[model samples]
Target: MARAAGLSRTTVSYVLNGDFRRIPEHTRQRVLAAADSLGYKPSAAARLLRGARSRLVLMVSPGLESARDTIGGDIVTRLGQLLAEADLHLVWQLGLPSVGRAATDLAPAVVLVAPTEEEAAFADLRRRFAVPVLPAFPGLGGFLAASARAQVDHLAGLGHQRLAFVRPAAPAFDLTAEFRQQAVERRASELGLPAPVILRVDDSRESAVAVLRSLRTRTDPVTSPVTAVCAYNDQVAFALLAAADDLGLAVPAEMSVIGVDGDPLGEWTTPTLTSVRSDTAAFVSDLTSQVVALARGETTTVEARLPEQARVVERSSTVGPAR
Candidate 1:
């Protein structure tokens, strides 16, 4: 094990003893692997006989039971993998009732999820947890603006001038949506657009389609009805496509559309969607790194960063302006 890790026996022994001082992430990974291979387990038998459990890190959230987003699931999967790879066990627990402290006693290091924007989850996690906190999202404007800019640039290059965006009314004032709107507007103006259009809809796809239908029927004062549109996600983007069809409009010929999220459904749609592809690999990788770091009894600070940028994925849903 020591030979594989390129570490002296003493060094490997130190890591096996849970003394992680002065070790880089790679080195730590190597030593952990080495110890596992050599079966140098942390003896609970010894610790129990000694009257103490080996302290470990834990992931503290408002309520693991209430986090129902697929995105969140993906994050947890990656995090679990990273922790396992590091010979660390991840424990997820909820702390409610108290807004600033966990209900249960925990290990010294904790990973509290503080999303970038103000969220009920963030409030519960940050103020309630007794350990280090890691932010899930980026610091508002910059990330959102960048996401919008990248999308807008791609659509414009595809001959989209009269473009639109579809979003739902956010009760919490979504920083992501706000950022995109601002960036879309600013960039459109600099590019000589009269005004960038945004359509608000209820959360449902049906409502979003109805809004798109209303938008399609309007007289576009910009010399052209919007020929291209952005949907909040691939589902809505596909709904917009259906909305155009219901309105007797031909896609790309009469209108074109794009969406965010490279959801698997996007590819199966009649016309595959052009979307902002999420680098799920990178997302998972970073999520794993962060969570495992926390699970290993290491401190996760506010600045523990991960990539959140969305990339464009081109497909048949978009086409050049009518020939």
Candidate 2:
């Protein structure tokens, strides 16, 4: 096969084993075409018998089948690059049901990057394969709780006494968002800020607009307005900002908004979103290191603690509330 493709045996092996990140794109294509023409397939059992490490990592994306690339592309890309350095390969499995003990037949570790609700189905995968099942979100083992804490602290420090947390009604099992909301509530009480309101808005621009309308409008002077909002993610934050604009409200002046996930599109918004962003480099490194350790029957303190840092990225979307 190596001779047929005019490439070295190691190069062919890398391509066949899905560890071809270091291989040039054109060369990879040639190797792939050769293998396709020869009807060749790499057998996991054969590699294992040869004393080769499985080197495969399966990432399960539940309820994000259609938007995994859009939502998790950055994290996945960085994770692949980091793993490839150690000759490990990462592959994504869509839908929760597709993940089970059978998945460990292809990899030694599984990364679950979905909500907590989908976790139960994979409990058997952990018990059956003895493989580590890691969560990549902020809450539940990642940096989400910290991200929410940062968002709340930033807004409260700016003198926004009354705050709100906004999330979509769908993806009811999005424990990441749920954790962020809880963090905000806890932080508010700790800071002596007014109790924050939680709003489950429909996941649409129009729904957000309507929600903003009701919140920002109150004829009663005694009603303390919600001066700051922390959205579940950048998508919801963007909607709220747009809705605020439609109502002719002066952001940061009359109201402030912040969100999580640090989506690149947030920077392009009219007022540039202020967000609580994941420490991508640290996150990828920690997750990769922990999974690699788990694969080797080694344990790390990271398993019992959150491994990523969350910090606020200030932008035009926030300021001290009006007196």
Reference-based TM-score of each model: 0.70, 0.74
TM-score of candidate 2 on Cα atoms, chains taken together: 0.74
Worst 10-residue lDDT window for candidate 2 reads 63-72
Best candidate (score: TM-score): 2
Tally clashing residue pairs in candidate 2: 2
Model 2 ranges with Cα > 4 A deviation: 1-45, 48-52, 63-73, 100-122, 128-142, 219-223, 293-305
Model 2: per-residue Cα lDDT over 117-221, one tens digit each: 246744544454445676654344346677888898899888788888998777743555677788888989999877787887775778988878777873446
Show model 1 residue runs off by greater than 4 Å.
1-73, 91-108, 117-125, 139-141, 170-173, 280-304, 308-310
Model 2: per-residue Cα lDDT at residue 106: 71
Over the stretch 225-294, how does candidate 1's per-residue lDDT look in tens digits?
A: 6777776666567777776666677776767778765677778886777877544566556656665555
